[model samples]
Target: MRRLAALVSLLLLPLLLPTPAQAAATPLQVYGAWHCGDDACIWGNVRSTTDFDAKNHWLIDRGDGRPSVNVVVLSFVHPVKLLHKTTDAQTLDGVPRGMTADIVNYFAGRGIRVMLSIGGITYTTAWNSALAENAAQFGRNAAEVAQRLGVGIEIDYEENSKPDLVGLQAFIDAYRSVLPYDPSGANPAARLTIDLAAGDRWLIDIGRKATADWLRTDTPVLDYANAMVPARQPSSSDAIANWQEHLDGKPTYSPPIPPLAPAKFTGAFYIAEGNKVRAECADFTASLQKSTGSFVQTAAPKGAGLTPGMLGYMFWAAERPSTKGVTTTPPNSCEGGVGGGATAYAIPIPMPALRQS
Candidate 1:
C-alpha cells in the first residue's frame, strides 16, 4: 500500500509543480567583470596583486551592496615592443609576464573565477607581430601565465581586418596542449575563451572563423566567445537579433553565412554608461528570467542558449578602462577609476537552469 501511495505521488509531481507563469523569476546569467589593471590605471592607480585597502572592492566585498561579479577577467597582457620578431615575453603594467596569485585568490576565495585577458585595442602592434610571428610562443606564454597565476585565459586580440587564422589555431592549440585542466589543480577552474567583435560587421574574418569553424567542432578549443560591445548599444531585442544574425546568417551576404547554434554567444555590455550613446541594451538590472525568447531563436524562456543559457554576461570592464574617476550611471565605490557594480558579488550560472546540471 505504501509503495502504491509513493508511486501515485510521483505521478502527480508534475501537477504540483509551478506552471511557466507561476514560476519565480530566474537569476541573471553570466555576471562577469573585466578587471583592466594593466595600465589604464593612470587615472586609477595600478592594481598590484599583493596590494590591499578599502578601494579594492573589485577584489573583495566592502560591506556595500554592489553585486560581486562571479568572474573577473584581468585585462591586457600586451606583447613586448619587438614587433618584428616572435617573442615569448609579454608585459602587464610594464612588468614582463608579471602576474601574482594574491589577486587571483583574493576573488577566488570568494567563489569567483579569475581569468587573464590578453590584447586590447591599444596593443594592436604587438598583436600583429605576436600572431604573425610568435603565435605559439604568445599562446604558450598566455596559458603559462594563467597557469602560474592560477587563473584562466581570455584572447582579446582585435586585429580583425586580416586575422591570422593559421597562427591563431596554433596559438590556441599550444595554449590548450600545455595547460590541461584539472579541477584539483591550482587553477582548476581555468578556461580558455576569446573576445569576438560585438557584432558581425567589424570583425568579419574572425566572426567567420567563430561561426564556420571554432564553435562547430566536437571538441572546441575555446570554451566560448564574448561578443564585445558593438559600435552602438542595441536594445535587448536588437542585441538578440544581432546575435542571431551572427549565429544563423542573415540573407544579405553574397554567400549566406553558415549558422552556428545559439549556445556559443555571450553578449557583453558597458556597465558604466553615462554620456555615450548606450548600446541598445535592455536595463542592466533586467532579469534573464523575465526576458522572453523573441530574440534567442529558441522556444525556451529568454537567455537560455547552448550548454548554459546564452553563454552568460560579460561587462566591458570591472573598472572603466578609459573613464577613470568619471561618475558612471551607478556611482562607483573604488577611487581613481569608475567601479560601477563591485559592492557585492554573484554566481554566473542561470538559477533555474542549474537544476538540470
Candidate 2:
C-alpha cells in the first residue's frame, strides 16, 4: 500500500507542475506600504520625524518613467473610530477625514488602488472590546470607514489575545455587508482585507483559520487576506514546507475554492545584516518556485520569506526607511544590538494586474 501510494504521488507530479503561464502569472496583489493621513503620517509616529508630503512619500520612485515598484496597499483607516474630532459621533463614524479619500485619489490617479488596513497591533485593543460586545456594529463601522475612504479595508488584527474567530467573523460580516460584491465593476466601492501574522505557532492557529475563512468565497467576512511579516521557517526549504503544512491542516471554516491560488510571500526589512538579506531572498524565491511553481520578485535579503503568487507583497510603515530609525541603535539589549542604514531594501517589481482595485 505504501509503494502504491508512492506510485500514485509520482504519477501526479507531472499534472501538478505549473505551466509556464502559471509560473509567470502575476500575483493577485503586490506593492509597498501606503501610509497617508494623520495616523500614518510621518509626523504622527515616534518612528519618524520626517513629514511625508503627498508627492514625496514612498508611494513610488521619482526618476524614470517606469515605476521602480508596483502595487501599493495603503495602510490604515480606523475601525469604529469616527472621522473629524467633535462631540458629534455620526461625523466620526467613517474615515477620520478626507485625507484617506485624497490619498486614494492620488494613487488612483496613477492607477494604484490602496488597501485600507482596519486595525493594527495597537488598534486591536479596541476590537477586543468591540467585537465580542458588538459584532454587527463592528462590521457596520468598518464598512462606513471604507466607504468614506474610497478604498478597501485590510483587517490587521494582530492581537494574539483576541484570537476570537467569532469576533473576526462578525467584523467581516459587517464589513462585507457594506462593500460591493464586484470589486472590478464600475464604482465598485471598498474592499475587505486582512493582514495576518506568519509566526509558526500563530500561523498554525490564528493565521490558518482566519485565512481559511477569507479564502472561502461563501464566507462574507473578507475578500483578501495579507500575510504580514512572514517569518522564515526552520530552513530555507521551510517556505514551501510551511505553506503545504497549513494547507494540509483542517480549518475551523473555509471557502469552496480557497482564497489563495499562488499564495502570498510578504516580509519586511530587506537590508538587515548587509548581504545576508539578499541570500535569504534568493532562497525564498527559489523555494516558492520549486514547491509552488511560481515566480517571485528578487527581494533583497535582510528578511525572511519570498514574494510569490497573486496576493502580491507589502512592508510595514512606508516612512521607516526615511525616518529616525533608518540608522539608529537598537533599543533593546538583544543580539546584533545596534543597526545602521535602511532596515529594508526596496523590491521594485511591477504588479499592475494583481488586485482589481
Candidate 3:
C-alpha cells in the first residue's frame, strides 16, 4: 500500500514540475543589423581600417563600450557573379574587394557574429539565371565563400510572382552537402538561413514552402528566416499584425502554409526610412522596437511548436541602405535607438546559443 502511494506521488511530481518551455523562456538570441557596405548594398572598394572605423564607430562602440548589435550581415553578394566566380577590379576571387578579412575581423574582434547576404531584390534576375544555369554549383560556390570568410550566409531570393522553388531547393541541398546544418552554431558556415517577405502576403509561395519544410522545428533545414521589412516602416500595431501572420499562417490559401516555429525566425524593423532617421535609429521610446517588444518576447505559439515568443529583432540596412538614405555615420548614428534596445534587452555580446525549437 505504501509503495503504491509513493508511485502515485512520483507521477504527480513529474506533472508538478514546469515544462522546458515554462522553466525559462528563451531570451532574444539574435539582435542583428544588415550592413549595406559603403556603396549602398554594394561593397565597391577596399577601405583602410582608419577610414572604415571613422564611418562605423557608432556600430562598434554604441556610446558605451558594448556594440549596438550582436550580429552584422554584410548585404549582398551578386548571385550571378558568385556563380560564375567572376573577378574584376572591384571583386577579388568572386568576393567584393571591400568585404575583405579586415572588415570581418573589425566586427568579429568586438565579439560580434558576421554573415554574408546573397541575392537582394536587385539580383532577382541574376538569381534566376544562376539557378537555371547550375543551382548546385552556385550553392557549392556560396559554401566555399562561407568557409573561406568564416561567416554564415543568408539567401535573399525575392521572386514574388513566380519562384523557382525546385532550383532553390537544389541550391540549398548542394550548400548543405558541403556544410551541414549545425545547431550548436560552432561552425559558421553551417549557419545557413533565408529571408522571407514582411508577411505571408508578399512571398506567398516561398513562405508557404519554407514554413512547411525548412522552418520546421522537428526537421529544421535552415537556421532561421528573417522577415524583411515591408515597403516602409509600419506602426507598432501594424508590425505586430505582420509578425502574427507568420505565427498563424494563412490556412485559406490554395496550398495552406503551416504555422512557423517561434524559434525559427526573427522579425525585422526599419532602422532608417530612406534619408530620414526613423525612431528605430534615433529614439527607442518612440520606436516600434519598443512598442512591439513585449509581443516579440512573449507572443504565444499559434500552430507550430509548444514554445512561446519569437527569436528576436533584425534591423534593416545599417550604414547607407539606399543612395539617398541617411548614412548611419556620426551625427545620424543609431546609438540612441538600436543601442538603447541592446541595453534594454541585455542582448548577449557574443550571441548566445539559439533555441532549436
Candidate 1 structure quality by residue, lDDT tens digits, 264-332? 556666644554422212232342212422233242322223332454557655444564433222235
Task: Please tell me which model should have the higher lDDT, number 2 or number 3.
Answer: 3
Q: Cα lDDT for residue 44, model 3?
A: 75
Better of 2 and 3 by TM-score: 3
- The superposed Cα distance between candidate 3 and the true structure at residue 299, in angstroms, equals 1.5
User: How high a TM-score does candidate 2 get?
Assistant: 0.60
Residue-level error in angstroms, candidate 2, position 267? 5.8
Instruction: Kindly list the per-residue Cα lDDT of model 3 for residues 127-220, writing each as its tens digit.
Output: 9999999999999999999999899999999999789999999999999999998888888778899999888899899999999988888888
Q: What is the lDDT of residue 49 in candidate 1?
A: 51
The residue ranges of model 3 lying beyond 4 angstroms of the native Cα positions read 1-25
Native-referenced Cα lDDT, model 1: 0.55
| Candidate 2 local lDDT, 50-113, one digit each (tens) | 3333333334333332332344554444544522222232223344443445555656655555
Task: Name the candidate, 1 or 2, with the larger TM-score value.
Answer: 1
Tell me model 2's lDDT, rounded to 2 decimals. Answer: 0.44
